[model samples]
Target: AIAEAIFRHLAPRATPLAGRHALVTAGPTHEPIDPVRYLANRSSGRQGYEIAGALAALGARVTLVSGPVDLPAPPGVALRRVETASQMLAACRDALPADIAVCAAAVADWRVAQEATRKIKKAQGAPPPVLALVPNPDILAELSTPGPDRPALVVGFAAETDSVAQHAAAKRARKGCDWIVANDVRPETGIMGGMENEVILITADGAEQWPRMDKRAVATHLAGRIAAFFTAQRSIA
Candidate 1:
């Protein structure tokens, strides 16, 4: 680590992401069902946090809009903590116009239409109360929309239990994002909430399968690709 730091200090030009702004979303959004209850997922925020750190290492100014997670903020990155999916979307919007945006948060799709003010007491011979649900804002699609506010590159994540690549491809087209990183999160795979991951990166060209590795390694690889993308764009211009 000491040697790497000395090398970085000696060669400042190695930071390819200098002057770039990156916006990343992490963890699981908690949509309220009531004062003490909420809808959420199993995301631990490790992958997203690692990605933020990797980008920051490459010298990008990163803003991580995260949901409920116990992890500390990555060094050299600005952290924005939020709970509900609506708040996550608002935070992402506020952090634009970024050069790159990675939508890695596992936001809840539905939220209780109306949260109960107080907990109901259990009673015998009574039917259970039915809770109405409403769809949350589609953050990936919104950020991918073609506009001045849209980032140069938008990446979304798809966690699927089956047919991961196929679903992710469809999602990329539907969401209008530049890239989609798809992974199998079936309990058997142990990728979700686990230390490692194997992913399929879908882009305009095609899907590329990445070997199983630690989440931090995956983050470093993705950050390198992002830097290469900007470099290619600059060369073309």
Candidate 2:
């Protein structure tokens, strides 16, 4: 607690991201299986919310495209609420031309191919309904794709149950993202819907394991890193 306070006090008061924009996706997308039924993950969006707040504190104009969550909006941030993966993707595209992009939402991998207009009925001694699923649009991949309007920095999050580092490194390469923040989400870890987190930050340079701490602390650390990156880039230019 004291350390965090000190870090914030020592940080430069100048707005590092004054003219820059940051895009972030948070929470879990709910893929509709039926009119009243949906498939979703256990992501509480604490980490993503903290990260967005951290970025905003540094003077970044932040656009947070969030899925269904019960958290309040961060101060000085533009909140765009969404439900499914498709909506989230559209929201992100509309907020384009960002300087940094963070893919933190635990987007559902597949959604019902055909949604039922009404509630599915339960019959006696009848077979259950079959739901045909289809792959969702890969939002992170799209953001990382090299082209005009690509953010200067692209960061992704990988929640894994096993081999956290290995999977995240491969995901970073496969998704063409600049960095991947990997964390174990096994039930025992209590990170899925908990307040604290332990993560390994993977970059082209390598990976660094962070200690378990409050989500806000991690956000502060990441925000500091981002500020330093922009500062260095400006110096080089």
Candidate 3:
């Protein structure tokens, strides 16, 4: 009670998401190649984590399913930590019946077919061992698919190096998600791990291009848009 009161006193803004539930995925999943080796990306989880905070500020019960990232958990948000794509998918399933779902994690496309129980050592003169890869579970697609437990709003992210809008639009349709926040992460852009982002929010109606801004601002804007969506839905229903 004291904590809640303190939080409210700090910012007495209206919480449009009051009594709602939100689920978010963040960070980069680690696909183990060996006991000491793993495949991962440079996703800092900044945007997603900030999104979770934004949603919490709007009075939503936020559950953040995150991977390995060097950041503290957002206050007033429940954090579920996992290391693998499969674990991430399982965590999302366990936190179902959400009002909104954001699939923002940079999950690896594949993992080693077989995980070695012991550490792999380099042979003095022999060739390196071969590693077979298999596709990882598609968490976004699973939740976006039509189902009784599907969230009212499903959002995904696409970090592309080329044809950002085109690829993100195609991905939105392919993944069956309502919105896809697309951004370019080419080497020159410095957006993959940077604090600022220039994103295009692709939806069924059309693409809404957002100007370059801090990730926190983007999250707050997106959260406000989400609140408007729910408000509109309630009116329609």
Candidate 4:
């Protein structure tokens, strides 16, 4: 089934994404405190990678700005590996003017103020070491805000453990993005770093709920919907 799906996706199609450049960000950014330790999320980059693959299959010039992930790079896509949120933003800036920009990366909200040159060890009579943290740049917010080189469509991911749809809808408005894909990451569900997820698609117009499906299926459906949206826009124009 996997092989057949790959072949079908790679087959040529007349989708609107074809021939247009699409930029996708995936995985969890690691914020280093010491050489051997870092703060990161549970995102495994599965969904982001699948989205890139789906877009590529539709013939889009796909550029994936990925964070640290164990998964292999997607076939037939330009891969830019980044470890920090700042680096990811730089890559996105360089890949601008794309038709679509998907911010799928679970970025670290905060980072250590100063990275330790040497790993701190336990002292004979001391307490645990203290670490100062500062907020990381909001990469999605920066991209979605009106800019000279902003993409036509900006999509963000909101991983919410509670009030999933409401949080995602608010994020869409707060981040100034065209759409937000909201996922529930509660303990029992295990959506984060998991194979399957139930998602709510939130846009300015309204919200749509989709049944739980594998990450690959979600990506395929999103790609097709994007194509249809562009088609409608063209017709209206």
Which one is best on lDDT? Answer: 1
Residues 15-92 of candidate 1 have per-residue lDDT tens digits of 888889999999999987767888798899999999999999998999999999999999889999999999999999
Task: Report the alpha-carbon TM-score of model 4 versus the true structure.
Answer: 0.92
Task: Give Cα-based local distance difference scores for all models.
Answer: 0.94, 0.92, 0.93, 0.88
Per-residue C-alpha lDDT of model 4 across residues 1-237, encoded as one tens digit per residue: 487457656764554576689999999999998888998877899999999999887768899999999888788789999999889889998998788899999999899999898987879889888889999999999889897778778999999889988899889989899999999998789877689978999988889999999999999999888777777887899
Return the TM-score for each candidate structure.
0.95, 0.94, 0.94, 0.92
When sorted by TM-score, best at the front, the candidate numbers are 1, 3, 2, 4
lDDT of 3: 0.93
Clashes of 4: 0
Q: What is the TM-score (0 to 1) of candidate 1?
A: 0.95
Worst lDDT 10-window in candidate 1: 114-123
Q: Which residue window of length 10 is worst by lDDT in model 3?
A: 5-14
Local lDDT at 84 for model 1: 92
Candidate 2: what lDDT?
0.92
Write out the backbone clash pairs for model 3.
none
1 versus 4: better lDDT goes to: 1
Counting only residues 3 or more apart in sequence or on different chains, how many pairs clash (N, Cα, C under 3 Å) in candidate 1?
0
Model 3 lDDT at residue 76: 89
